[model samples]
Target: MNDYVRGSAWRVPVTACQPRPLSAFLSRNAQRRPASAIRSLLPLEQEPGMISLLAGKPNPATFPIEEIAVKVRLPDDASSPVVVAVTGDRLQKALQYGPTAGTPALVDWLAQLTSSLHGRPLPAQSSDSTKPWQLAVGNGSQDLIVKAFEVILDSGDTALLQSPTYPGVLPALCVGQVNTVAVESDEAGIRADALERMLARWDVDEKTSSLARPKLLYMVPTASNPTGTSTSLDRKRALLRLARKYDFLLFEDDPYYHLSFEEATPSLFALDGQDSDHDQGRVLRFESLSKVMSAGLRIGFVAGPSVLVDAINKYTATSHLQVSGVSQCVAIAVLEQMGHRGFLQHAARTADFYRRRRDAFERIAHEILRAEPPVAEWTSPGGGMFLWLRLLLPLNANTAEGDSFALISTQARRAGVLAVPGVAFLASSGGTSTYVRVSFSLIGEEDTAEAFRRLRRVILDL
Candidate 1:
């Protein structure tokens, strides 16, 4: 139990961040991970005139499916649909086995998108130890996030995550036998002041005293899943400072980055070291196309230091290999037609759709749930697709505020409308909380008011 500081001198002039040594972060297993024999040679096949029998790629003549034509709707609802076709070499690559990292066209496009949006240079490659920051495509952000925890943390290692996190990521963290500690959150994501105070008293805090210091901190900075709250830019800078002060990388699982109701807030990835004046690769950003694009396509990516990304690539090589080449082909084809500006404009349109839905849902919710003796209350979300309600319930023995687990699952289910119980989002024992999460992403406006009334009945019945 020692401090994350060194000699009490933690300041650097505003300049290009010096890369932290790979040794500081990588786990023993990641260090020993062997390169895939065939995957390693896959890159060499691209050299000019390099006629060599290096790969066992199947001849395309033996395969079926010649061309891929996908019908895409315009971002403007008024515009007619257009068809995007992938043919010739592009189609061949789509049908054929591709690189382990991703289809070069798709991965490069994502890197360029990140550079444009985050205000960083395209993935830097250098002979120096400045471990180039790069992006690696994955089946989904979930796939890469699980693999990341495996690469950086060992069995006894600790990882801090904002409480009431996305429940889907919990199983992955649990599998590694890694300690997942909850840092209390607020209406605006992670409580930075509380986090700083907790870190400062790490050795003395009963919950963390005997455990390992955190190697990573997990957060869904924009539109956090269950909370439906987005962190402000100023708050983001404060969290970045803590990451710098306490030598831990921030795992920004941002599936809702593009779904923000307002202009997207700058991520920890972009502000990695703005406060500390050094960007030592403290942010490992996991981006997803699931929300904005088709979730079935399973397109997501990790944008961070090449050191961690290469480890993820190694995991990819051994696990699912890569995201569907055909999926990448379809996505990249549509993206190309849209171009960067068009793609962003389309995302904005998508955000607007959700924004309207959120407003309608909340308006109806407040009308019913807040009448007389209030049945529930919540902070309206700034972004994302959920309305997190604090269900007021009769106090019980274990919980000062009654739990939502039974009520949400049993009563709400019987009422013919169901929402996720707050207990599911928690990682600790006795998952008790007064919150329940409901989404406004799908239900039509016509059914919006009715849904809240049914929910109101269920809560009142309790």
Candidate 2:
């Protein structure tokens, strides 16, 4: 027999390799691309101070608005509610449908804010476009994340998520049927070595082989969701280098960027030089005004290659038109009032407040509850709202044998203290966990002591 015929004898039918019509593909394939009306215009607007014949932007003059005042006392020494004002034509633009990507002024201000905060310049466009790496606002960071995932993950396509990640991303990926590869995280966030190993042996790894190649790696680089770990600068460089070597996208879900405990760690985006090398479309950084400001405001944005952003905006336009103009207006007003330094000061106060709470809780966990020779271990969050704790139970906690799910849900609730279970954070079923996630952002100082006391009792009983 001919070599080709003999080799092909063991192969499946040739129809498997035959090209099929687009109509035959799965529903996700039909809906794989991004949808955003506003995100598309980002390129045209980038025409470096170009005038508009393209955008149907409502003139600010036509918009009817005078001022929007947010009543909240500034942190620091300020003693009264600082009513930030949004006046003039700027207020009008904010109140109207405006642009799909975002209001020009707001996007500009955000780009500048990101640059100043991260110590990187605004991304330079490949071609001398008026706009470079611009901004597109969403209801919150979650909004942008859903949109971004839609743009990249197809049905059955793969994504890499750090194990014990934010619970929010779970449902979104599930609804889309995207296969998630859980990469274990160390105290330093998503393990760079694990990521590289997985990618290198994709075909060989039994866990990864049946799935499609992963097109994106999702991570919260600063104060990661459940672990409260941040990737070091060296790790960032290594991750970036590996992404370049492999050509997959890096979804940097960094809403807590400002809340980092390390005041001076380098941001992944800043290391990519504000994404000047669009080829490294490798890093797509997501930010939000939620955790730092107010979660109710529902404002967040993504910065990366124009191509990807445009895809996302396509999904946005077809669905939401644009994020609420009213929210955009309010956010722009607040940002303009705060500028860069004032904003940083406010953020620093918020971060410091959470840090203090973390310190207090850790001390109590060590002193009172752990006094009986310790029953749990936890990583100290540098900056962010949560402290992830791993309980040492006599039973098999990893398999949920002695997991805290029932303890916190039933016993702890009865005890008047509540927390999220570690199983909720685990992406897979078989993986064992003895961990529990606690949020310090919403809890008050007076309640903290009692809460830990209640938590201690549950562990002792277990």
- Candidate number with greatest lDDT: 1
* Cα lDDT listed for each candidate: 0.81, 0.72
Q: Compute the lDDT for candidate 1.
A: 0.81
lDDT of 2 by residue, 1-462 (tens): 111111101111211223222122213432554434444564575587788676566666654566777865555445776787776666665676656677777788888888776666676644423334556777788888888887666666677888888889889899987788888788877788888787777767798766666667788899888888888878888887766665456888999888877856777777776455444345678999888887887889988666566656666777777777778777777666666777889988878888888887778777765677577788788778888888777676256446777777898898888889888887755555678888887777668778888878877876
- Cα lDDT tens digits for candidate 1, 206-225: 97777776778999989899
The per-residue C-alpha lDDT of model 1 at residue 136 equals: 82
Residue 359's C-alpha lDDT in candidate 2? 88
Top candidate, metric TM-score: 1
The worst-scoring run of ten residues by lDDT in candidate 1 lies at: 7-16
Q: What is the lDDT of candidate 2?
A: 0.72
Residue pairs in collision within model 1: none
Q: For every model shown, what is its TM-score relative to the native structure?
A: 0.93, 0.83
